[model samples]
Target chain A: MSDTGLNPDMVSSGGASAAPPLSRIQGVDKVFSNGTVALKNLNLDIGRHEFLSLLGPSGCGKSTALRLLAGLGEPSRGEIRWEGGAPATGSATDKGHRDIGFVFQEPTLMPWATVFGNVYLPLKLSGVSKAESVIPVGEALEMVGLTGFEKAYPRELSGGMKMRVSIARALVTRPKLLLMDEPFAALDEITRFKLNNDLLELWRQQNWTVVFVTHSVFESVYLSNRIVVMAARPGRVYEELEVDAPYPRGEDFRTSADYASHCRRASDALHGAINA
Target chain B: MTMSRPDDDEFIPLPGLTPAQKRERIARLVLPGLILGFAVLAWEIGVTVNEVPHYILPAPSLIAETLIKDWGTLYGSLLVTLQITFSALIVATLGGAGLAILFTQSKWVEISFFPFAVILQVTPVIAIAPLILIYVDTVQVALLICAWIVAFFPILSNTTLGLNSADHNLRNLFELYGATRWQTLLHLRLPAAMPYFLGGLKIAGGLSLIGAIVAEFAAGSAGSGSGLAYRILESGYRLNIPRMFAALFMISITGILIFMSFSLLNHVLLRRWHESAIKREN
Candidate 1:
């Protein structure tokens, strides 16, 4: 993907809101040292408690945008403002971690640690003693349906179970903002669907603002309230589509005409992005 | 629905070995033993049939006899060699790993001193033993320095690689979680480097033993307080081939024991996670 047409109006395109966003990406550009413009003039506003999906094909800077939101790296030109100006840095930098929990494309677990230990990591880093962390860690594991496997190592668990552990680890910190970069992309469909249901349940219950990045049209439509279709070559937003579906979306929703229409809309937008 | 969990209880000290794995483990021991038994038997028969002189080519039986007969003198030499080998290995472990940690903490330090470490490792310990002995007043200290140089590099290089090779994603996670530098080193880097450090320890164990013997030979320190190497040298000069073989046997046994212990340590430390230690069904 190469940078070509610069859409001036695309800057903060769909970010107009009454209440302040959980985080705002304004005129952000990420140009790597190798001179590949991963993102150019990208804009998005992650609202509180909204399941927003950054949908795009590969090289569309979807992950880059998510990382930028996480404060993983500085945007080449613009700025990402978390709620209340810049993030406060004490012990936890409030960057990619502190008030934010990030799940990468891979499970990214510490193989040597047990499931409990892996989940306990964020708490542990924040200076919570193991004794103090037991409740939160257990709750996280319980949420991910991995309570019984706390003693298990990553290698001993199946791929799906390992990913559950990763999810549990992300949830243990109980961050208001959860940034997932195609967390279920590597999973089989059955497991992915199960995790999607579980994740949606957790998001609804906890009221977390989740910015999920994925290319799967069906997954984006099924799990997200808002899907931002992004085009490649200096990744920029192409379209913002909303799924006005209610809570507790399950197998019925997955098979419904509503879900199909949403998927169709997202699929067409993605095709447009790929061809553009 | 619950996750598809493994049926076997994971915390079992020894996971129930599959029949194939059991058979493989048995063969690992029995096969080597069988071959060694036949070889020893052949040697015994060949010596008797040829009527070879004991001084030139002692039979296995004669070597065993010599080992038992010279137990007092040989045992003392064995202790001396053991002392030096273990001392060198312990010192090398601490020094090498400490230096590796230091090197990893600062790129400038590594760049400045890594070449010197390489020089010490590549140059033969035997070639430098005479100079060490001449410069150092204490023969034991000189031998230790020589053996230490021989055994130090593996731990240094392997640990450096291990510390640096911690999973990048995990490093990012640690940074994300605001893990302190000490916490990262202790929790992430140390555990990740364990298998590598154990691997280096195994190699250094054998190398230290070899270094001790080679350095002793170069020193040519005989009489009382001498190691097994001097005993072998003394036996050779006196044409006591059986005694020489007996000392050689002890050295071989010690080396095997060192390797086996380190292997056991590696297995115990990494059985739960590392691919090298885990027993796969496929």
Candidate 2:
């Protein structure tokens, strides 16, 4: 299902009516108690099944924006709408079992659980019996190419395998929106490249709305349909770049002229934001 | 890069060939046994040469003879001491784990109660044994309580620290998964605490033995039903030095047994995945 030789907006055309926006943020602002303004009057629309990346420098509050959307933290001001309506008002803690999934920068696999047990956790929390959870857990493991590692403990797995388990855990719940916070930041370059390809494949198959947070310009350009660049020290949107690269873009695309130009543009934008 | 063959993972190497391999491997036994045998030989020789009084450092042979001759009385007292130690150990495990869970749940409870736990740990069991005897009615129960007090804190402190020491990232993952507080405690926190709890248990195992013996000393209960502590005292008073040595030997053996049992348990639970369990060849 590669969107080869296609405009960025082409992916949004046919499903525009059927798959409504999964999230809408309108003029959201976040200020900390220490007199630090983290986000300033940000407005964005996240469409269903679109892999949107928030790219910026280290303290640009990309993580904060993701946190706000995940309902882990409240926006200091303005509205966040989910599924065409304003997000329910209250503390994020009050959201009582939301169906959102999050993968952190670190693998964050539970040390005490086996690979299978970690993937099965959300279902177990939802009161699914062990017998019923087996099929879904196996399928998730299979998706991540960790079929035989079910009984292996987290400590027994390599760093990449651990992250794969973490990904499997997030995917097992079948969430509509998947939020990732620099999940591959700790992996080696080669592993990160492979995982990025696998992630895009999973995105194509599952069609979940994704909001990825990253500090790397190249990663954002390669993976996102649109990149929302933010500036640091009272973060606000500096610019939004739509990546016109076709879907299922492979290693060869990384060597192409288009990829280099996109990376250069993103890099210059980031540099300008930082210098300013 | 090619991965190592899966069969290589299952390989267990033997050091050498022939009975000598078995002898060399089991030769660890020889050193300790030789030392013990030499010590016994020296004792018997000293008794013969110096014509030392039987009331003082009796020969190992004499001690063994006394142990065998008085097997009924010594056996009965051994049973009593074992009962007290095991009972106290059970109480400590339950009470320590329960208090640890409580401390993990409430910050205020931890702050208020943790110092008291420290105080209990540092205070000498000998100093409190008399007071505990005064308050508690039965000798057995008083001894058990004192032993529990001495043994309980390490497990409590270690397990509580372990529970709080869970990986911060993992805790966040649990929160993202919408796990309830109790579910997190049962599934994540408690299992993380196991190794620490086992560490504490190893320490507590020896302490329980010491506590039982010390409590018995403070209680000053003697005669047929008294524990091994009384046997040591009785033999000492009667100048049956060999029997006293035998009682001391039994106590040391009990301590080693406790250590071995806990080490075995630690191996059985964590050996499959933990580094501590994997034996390295040097």
Best by lDDT: 1
Q: Tens-digit lDDT track for model 2 on B174-262?
A: 76666789888988898888889999999999988889988888887432348999988888788888889888888999999999999
Candidate 2: which stretches are off by over 4 Å? A1-20, A27-41, A84-98, B1-51, B221-225, B278-282
Tens-digit lDDT track of model 1 for B1-282: 222332222333336778888899999999999999999999999999999999889999999999999999999999999999999999999999999999989999999999999999999888999899889888899889888999999999999999999998888788777678899999999999998999999999999999999989998943234799999999998999999999999999999999999999988899888889766555
Q: Which candidate number would show the highest TM-score if scored against the true structure? A: 1
- Residue pairs in steric clash, candidate 1? none
True contacts kept of each: 0.30, 0.15
CAPRI-style class, candidate 2: incorrect
Error of 1 at B159 (Å): 0.7
- Kindly list the per-residue Cα lDDT of model 2 for residues A133-216, writing each as its tens digit: 788788778887777788888777767777888888887777778899999999888778878878887887787788999998
lDDT of each: 0.84, 0.79
The interface root-mean-square deviations, each candidate in sequence, come to 5.1, 7.9
Top-DockQ candidate index: 1
Report the C-alpha displacement of residue A261, candidate 1, in angstroms: 2.2
